[model samples]
Target: MKNLNKLYILLFAVLVFATSCEDLTEINEDPNRPTEVPVEYLLTSAERQLGNRLYGGFDNVAFGMTVSQYWAQNEYSDETRYQFRANTNNTFWSDFYTAINDLQEIKKVNTTIDKGQQGINQNAVATILQSWAYHSMVDIYGDIPFEEALQGVDIPSPAYSDQELIYSALIDSVSSAVAAIDPSAPGFPGGDVIFDGDLSKWQKFGNSLLLRIGIRLSDVNPSLAEQTISAAAEGAMKSNADNAAIQYITAQPNVNPLYVSYVVNGRQDYCATENFIELLNGLGDPRIGEYFVPAANTGTFEGLPYGVTSAVAAGISRDAVSQLNPQVYAADFPGTLMGFVETSFILAEAASNGWIGGSAADYYAQAITASMNYWNITDGNAIGDYIAANPYTEDNLKVQKYIAMYYEGWQSWAEIRRLDLESLPAANLVEIDPAVNFVDVSNILNRRLYPQDEQNLNGANYQNAASNIGSDAYDTNLFWDLD
Candidate 1:
């Protein structure tokens, strides 16, 4: 009996020792802070990041709106003068790649575990978003680390791919994404913040994005442009219902950046540009009221002079200049990634370019109609009258497109650069008062400077890119920007 008791004690001690070893092995693991997560969480993050970065804050307000001359600084007018923050370039580059890397991971995850039609749909969605992010990066930086990007330590110093090559790949990627999308299948399980698990809308958004991408090559590769645009228009966003936008709710950490910038932060740094206000007033455009608020002191829709000296900007009272409209800075304003209004304009341009079989005038009218409807201007008479007044000349279509791209600063800036729209910036104001600390606004920023971090960390590759692109200056134009 004593021998039996000794054996039992020994077994119990062994069991305890085994349990302690198991616990020690799992000491690094934390259930609350998981290393691996469902792809749904990643989708939500990537979509949100893309929407915010493209639609507002430094990318939109300072770089896009100011550079596009839609808005100008009321006090510090340096950004309007083409003197952008270096850190912003770094942040913008990082923001895009981070979202893109997350998207790539989603694709990887889908391939590994959920290898079914649902997984295919998820992967397709990821590919479309990745293409969009890459397209934006190439559009801004001209040449960027693609192909080899997101390879981790395998290729830490990835070579910058030519913008032309990058665009070609993006075109293929978008096409594949569209084809792969099975709208009938379950998508993303949950956390699809943009369209709420609607794969059909995702397909349409992809095609619309593809359409925009094709139109961008109109100047550089017309044949490819025609072919791609023709194919994409067949499946592009048909109405406001199909628009790809992130509708921000009145919640902490998820509110629209415009609200955070103008309301929460209580910043009065920006005002409507004199050029923009003049354009609106000249046309009697109703969107003027939709876009800007009346001057605080004057109660008139006055504008601040764009690209002027800081001294000149400081002289203008903040209360005397029109700030962005309240509705724009409202908590619930949708941050549009791509919309029917934009796709309509793209179709119009394609039609005008003889790339597609549609009436340019009709498409142009539809674009204006879409824009009006989007802004809650639903009167039939008002819509008809506006469309009629703005006919379908090439210049008219481009100008109207510019007008419609009010809040989407990046797209506006891209259009401004692509079309070289001299009319919008009023002679593209050359080095305003050269005697003062001047930023050369003569040539609207052709391309953003490469991130300073790239130079420091990826020095050799950065040097090669700068050399290959013929200097990393703002004057360096992307391949598509060439006439």
Candidate 2:
């Protein structure tokens, strides 16, 4: 009887121990946090972050809009007057790097979990996005971490890469990515927000981006530029349907950047600049009404002069200056990354340079027509008349390009620098208030200064880059900016 009772006790103890062990394991697992996230979720997050960085934030409002002279602040004109802050600079740098990191992770996971053609398709998309993010950073800062970037624990302090070398790598990466994508392959169906898993559109986007990079190197390496542009022109974006854009939802977190900035924040800081308005109005461009609302008091479109002092701006009535159109600030407005119109313009430039087969004038007219249509100016006669009035001269090409790039502030600023659009800044400065004579209008910023954190954290590499690029100043011209 004693032996049987001991056996029973042992059996009970074993059961209790097993149950407790299972409970312990369950408790150790966290429901609130995830060790690994789906690559689809990561892609969505990256797209949203990129949109926020490009379309919203101080970087867009202060540096992009101000430098482009598309919009000017009612007060606190430091950013508009070419005064950059370290905090703002750091924000732009960090945000883009974060998005790039997310893209890299997607590539890693897609390689691990997916195989064959599907894996190739996923990786190609990630590579294209990574290329774009890197290009934006390189264009803004001149030199940045490229080869060793997004290495996680492997490279805590990556060295800065040369801008020219970085551009070359980006061009190659994008070209390879475009080639790797197979439209027939199975795609990660829900992952793509921009094109909804359409591999062909992604291919077109990559090719269009290639064209942009190719043209960007025209002045520095004309032969390579010509070769690259010719190849890209064969498969680039064909029409507005292929434009790379992020469509925002009319909801809390997914609202458009302009809506978050203007509506949710209730900030009336930015108004259309006279520089932009005058250019459109002078050309009788129909996009003027589409881009801005008529002033509240005057019941007509008016704009504040760019780079004005606070006192000069204060004298003007706020109600008389044109604010951005409400439609642009709508929650569902799509945030454009690259557009078909831009591709058309690039083709026009390539034609003019004799790098491609098309007639420059025909490409120019197509580009203007595309731009007008993009802004909802669908009238055939109106577009034809505008095209007729504005001939395909080099000046007209540059001017129309500038006008077409209304809300695309950073690109506009870069294009002005690359093309040396003398009239853009020159004509605007002539109208500057005499009382606001402190700023040297002749020395407009060519590039943004490196964030102060780079100096502190990556001291040696930062110093080397600064030395290579000439003082890390805003006035320093990038390698491609011959002007």
Candidate 3:
């Protein structure tokens, strides 16, 4: 009887301990912290991430503005001289991929949870944004890992797809996304910052992006370009109202990137390039004042010489050269991902190339008008006068597009290379200061070299891509860049 009692008590104690362990496990899960976030939150995060990188100070000025010669470094001058920082390059490469991954997650979550019209719309928006980010990446770095990029551990080293193949996939994806959007459905009621869940606007943006992508393949794959451009032209953005942009707020994490780079950081590190400002001045452009401020010292719009040595740059007075206008860096300024002005210019180019059914001259005039209006050049007379003076010749079309694309450094650089504008006198591709040749190459940058991390982490794939891309030199033209 004693042994029986002891055995029973031991069994009861064992059961109690097991119950306590289960209770402890349950307590570990805090209700305040969620393992998974809603898809809408993911959308906002992905958009914000891309917005900051695209328009923010570091990558924006270092790689895009400086390389394109829109804005030169006022102090360091290294990036302006084409010596891009390794960290800047790495951040640009990684940040874009990170945003793309987030967008991919949104698509997956929406597809699984909501199979209804709302899910369809959400998926479409995510697809379009993914394409936009990929397009920009391909344009800058030539070939990139597209289909297999965001697979995490499953595919640690994604092989770089051919640029031609990537373009085809992007066109098809964008078209499908546009078709999938249900205008009647309410999409992301809370997190749709770009268009406020407006499916129609998203459709227009998708089509416009399609047009842009198609135009890029004009030289490499003319048949596909023509087909894609013709189909996209009808559905592209109709006005500035359809612009795919995000307006920042005057708050902690949402301030305009320019404001953070200039005002918040209190850095006087950038100024207008002599080439860009002089071109605007000679054209009698009204937006010069809108684009830059008059030098405080001279009370005139002077520009710092492009690609000069830091020693030479140090000699120049900060108050002597025009700085970016305060309006540009204002906290409430909008970061444009794509807008009507760009679509108009793309249409003009497509029409000029005989890929679309429109008068090239008419499209060109509209593009110029749109650009002036975008800059808030209130004087209609000034816009008309400028357009009339610079008619729709092929050369004029490229030059006007370059000017209109001010502050849009990546697009400007891509266009300049795509059109082979280096030969044009107005492009001012040759060194301004012949005595000081900053870059090793005579021509402007063609493509950015792949991030060093790629070489280190994904060695075999990186080696193959670099080898296939003809040495990965900065001057190596992309597959689309026949020139």
Candidate 4:
């Protein structure tokens, strides 16, 4: 309905028709099965769906939900080895294929390879999206269909690829295709509902993501991180406007994921982690005001530390503790899964490694600044004072970044896992007890397990992947998240 040059779907229909016209169309002579749709219509759907996918897509729910990023953070609890191992939400791989299929159709429509041209930009976005979709598939499933993916009816059970190779290809494709966007050219704008066909913004988004890739390999391959950052800086998102994102409507099907969750209505079943609130409150970070609404008539706003015990529950009423912090979960999901704030944090980490053209400290400061600004917390002096007065350290740097990324469940979850769940001294908070014996609490949180649908659909593959994972709930690490 809301097509910002949403052309992905039209292209998909065309491919479907052309491929099935001979065989399928002959049998099912009703005439609507395989049909050619306008390229414009396909692009509009692509743009529209991209916005949808960015905010907790099926792939996201599959990965994030399985990983405890979805419930544990909301429940303020931990995962058992079993809970994380055979999670029921593993149906995301199928959903990702759904996205890939749409994106590939869009790419096929723009078969031309003219750089700086409208068709090329459209194709480039599709390429970048394909790389992201594929990267996510492997990131969640370890090794998955890469080269032979999205052929749909072409290849039913495509062979999987190595995770490392998939990621490596993703890194290359993203940089190359994104860099292909020509900022200084007249372009068609219909297929670009997200950015109004602004090629420069597309370039910025690509670069911002490249910075993300650079930081992802920071621990695993430092030299690779350096090289990725150096190249990404060529067109990185310098300002918030360049962020590759779309604002969701508070109304209807476009509601934010968190917005739907925090609803008192049965649609949501999670709450904020005490760990998140206490850290934000302790740092006196202004974003907290923007994030949550504190207990009514408490006389002051306060958040319990990570892993709260009733004894340390402070003076708040019991009801508030067991529920989603009202201060944070608005009726709307204005929160972002990916955006300038996320990219800026990635850049901060990259800059800290001296990978790009700025001081680590400056980038870190700006990262926090972007977080605040994105949240509409515009007191520049307050943030400036916080940066000037506070000492910069690698730990605190990541801590603030961690706090800023709270709304982005997967990113924060990934960061904490990468950093060994060590709580930085950046915030003044008490120690987290491994043995938390609190009322209504079950266990300490850890990784999300493989989801259930995987068993029913990709049963054998899921079983094999699960066997390769370790047994420890709190200690297990992904290939890239290894200590």
Candidate 5:
């Protein structure tokens, strides 16, 4: 099953049309047209693409699955693949700006969609989606083309805005949009790829997204965090059923975005990481069955040992081992596509720390239990029981969170970069000797350097972006990662 479809995004680059003044003038051109091409279509398209692969450098799947603490650390040569770096092959900024342009176009006529029956909710949904795009864009590339971004033809050569501004905007935008959702609205879109366009569900999505943004600001702004979590708890997801995940069709050109490369194309390239697998297995957790292929025909589930060395990598056979593969991917696999579980987990952490006034352990247990139930593995076991039976030490929390975050994006890696989770039973191939570095923390890699294109397409600007953050490659940390 080892083949080559994952390279599609790596090899293909989208040709964005030059923006014309008219194109940027309107966000939605039509009020009622099934399959109608609207200016604001880009919002939906970009949100969906968040699940799809854009380029070699910005794959949420690979980064979340392989690089982050949730999964394996590469046995290959470069940790560049494990963390964020300016990749020569990635075009995330271009993709984001293009989407931004589309969003702006839709915003121009966004009010048109606010007709009698279900106008308010429709507008709110659109706003919520746009907020998601902005958050995602700046999270990957700090200080991106914001403010002037998504302005369509308004500003062709949009200037980069500080990442901080983008984050701040998301907080306000998502908050306001959520407040506007008319849950009782009768008229909503007929076809929704995610959440079936249910206004209530959209409200939950908006609230959950708010919770995510709140947590992102925890270390930097505790006051904001406390306030935001309080609001998040009022409307965020209550169960796995309320998740804001999009369901990709398995139909041609519509299959689960990951399917095109990992399954149908015949290339079983990516697999579960040893670090991810070991932690779950050690806890006697059941999610392994849902996430990985049980070692294959011979029937052994091979869970790899984490932080294995190059020599150790050679020792593990690929036979029916405990590992995850895309082919065996289930419909309900604990997913990275934002959901109630993640939102709950964030709230749980907030409450636990007293950053907000709620039960931390209660939220934590709910998050974990909901996640387990998501995999259809409800065996009468509760998350509290599991945590109590097991040691709720720092390491356990790290590993548990890692397991909970499978298939999520670089957030887990961010957690590792910022917080020193009690050590895992794994080894790190530290580039700099701990003794010589003289730094308190041993060997830790932060932000990824600018990809090759920085020196090519946007050379001067890339250098500035790199310098702003301190490093253009993987060795440097982001402004937010400062502990």
Candidate 6:
């Protein structure tokens, strides 16, 4: 009986060893998860994710609108008050990284799987997007993971690159991307949500982006700025038709981010800010109704004071404050990444700096006309009148730029900060309700704080970045913001 038991145990051990030695990798693999996806699908996903990050409600309302003084919170005023919850930064950081990772994957697949002249075209598109994602990060956080970012399992803790260096690399990347495009080569038509696989438009968009970045360095690195601006102006966006924008559908997942925030979430948290509305109203801007709705109670436009406390906000009737235009808040409204209006403004600024050819006034007029056209303000007389009323004064240029970037809160805030607009005060211009606690009226926030996760997951890098920037406070100025 003992011998028989030993034999059975020995057979069982051999069976277990054989089973473990066999290729169980395939059996253990999850059927649902894909090891690789089509490049076109990845491209489409990257574009959608980028749009969501850029135009999403959380960033727009919670940070951008309040900082830019374009919109104010009706009830939850913590963000406006600059008392940001930890999760706010975390969410933004995560979303951006997710998009960045996908973009990186697109580049990888383009190089490895689709290597050819056709692959070069696709790779160029991916490279431009990667540049854009990195540029946006640098703009917001000053310095971020650029050199070794998206390395996956290879390098988990990528060191932060200097913002100046990142800007240089981004400019080179965009330039190379534009140069590498082969129009005759096959392209991912279905994947391109912005330009419909038009390599020419993509090149134009890259040049436009270059113009933006070049001008960004105008205050800090004037020589490089002049050179870059001059070069980019040669191929930058020429017309409103060439604008880089993403059109959203009426479907649930693909709906406009504003619609998701306002309708799906059932929240009326945002109202037009008194600062922005007063500026537009003062200018008699024809796009007022296109941007905001009339107050429900008075049937006239009214704006809420920005950065007010919850208690102060609670006292105001919701219907008395102007909400976003219904058209803007609709699910199908197109989200703009870059437009000719913005490019024109960049040209105007460059001309003012003597970095590019053409009269500043001409570019300024073109910008206004483009903006009007973008908003569907086709009344020729109205546009002509508005253009005549607003000339190319420096102050007027900055103000108009601010107004043109209404839905694009981040860009507006960046412009406001870059220009150091003394006219539009975020904190001290209009006195907040005395009842509002935690209001820091002394300092204006210039940049968003680094993500809190950086402190925990990447403590050493976080400390270095914070020290390099002088402080981790939202009031710290970026390198390019040296006025």
Number of the top-ranking candidate, with TM-score as the measure: 3
Predicted candidate 5 versus true structure: per-residue lDDT over 1-483, tens digit per residue: 124554554344322233443565554455465453553355467555554543222365445444453444223312322323444235555555555555555555556555654665666776787677677655655666667655556665456667777777888888887888777776345545566667888888888888877777777777887788777778887777787665665566544655554565644434555545565666767787777777664674555443444454445565535555553343322224467677767876787677667776666666677778876668764545676765444455555665676666566555665454423453222233333332333344454444465457556666676667665554565556555
Query: What lDDT score is found at residue 403 in candidate 4?
Result: 71
Q: In candidate 2, how many clashes are counted?
A: 0
Across 1-483, the per-residue lDDT of candidate 3 in tens digits comes to 999999999999999999999999889878898766788888888888888999877777777887778788788887776777777778888999998999899887775685688888888999999999999999999888887799989999999887778888899999999998889877787787788778899999999999889888888888998899899899999998899987788996777888887888898688999888888888888889989999899888889888888988988988889998888888878888888988998898888888888899899888888888888875787778888999889899889888888888888889999988777898665554534555576577899989989888888888888888887888888999988
- lDDT of each residue in 300-391, candidate 1, tens digit only: 78888777888898998888889888898888898888899889999988888788888989999999999988888899898898778877
Query: How does each model score on lDDT?
Result: 0.85, 0.84, 0.86, 0.58, 0.59, 0.83
* Candidate 2 stretches greater than 4 Å from native: 1-34, 423-441
Q: What is the TM-score of each candidate against the true structure?
A: 0.93, 0.92, 0.95, 0.76, 0.78, 0.91
Candidate 6: list runs displaced more than 4 Å.
Answer: 1-34, 423-443
- lDDT score, candidate 5: 0.59
- Candidate 2 lDDT over 1-483, as tens digits, reads 999999999999999999999999999889877677877888888888898888875877677777777888877776676666778778778888999899889887876674789888888998998898888887888988888788878888888899999999988999999999999997666867788889999999999999889889999999989988999898999999999988888998888887888899998688888877777777787899999988899888889988788777778877989988888888998888899999999999999999999799999998998888888899999999999998898878888888887778888878888988754552342234434544444445678778888788888888988998887876789899998
Task: Score candidate 4 by lDDT.
Answer: 0.58
Q: After best superposition, candidate 6 residue 397: deviation in angstroms?
A: 0.5
Candidate 3 lDDT trough over 10 residues, lowest sum: 429-438
Better candidate by TM-score, 2 or 5: 2
After superposition, the stretches of candidate 1 with alpha carbons farther than 4 Å from their true spots are: 1-20, 26-33, 423-437
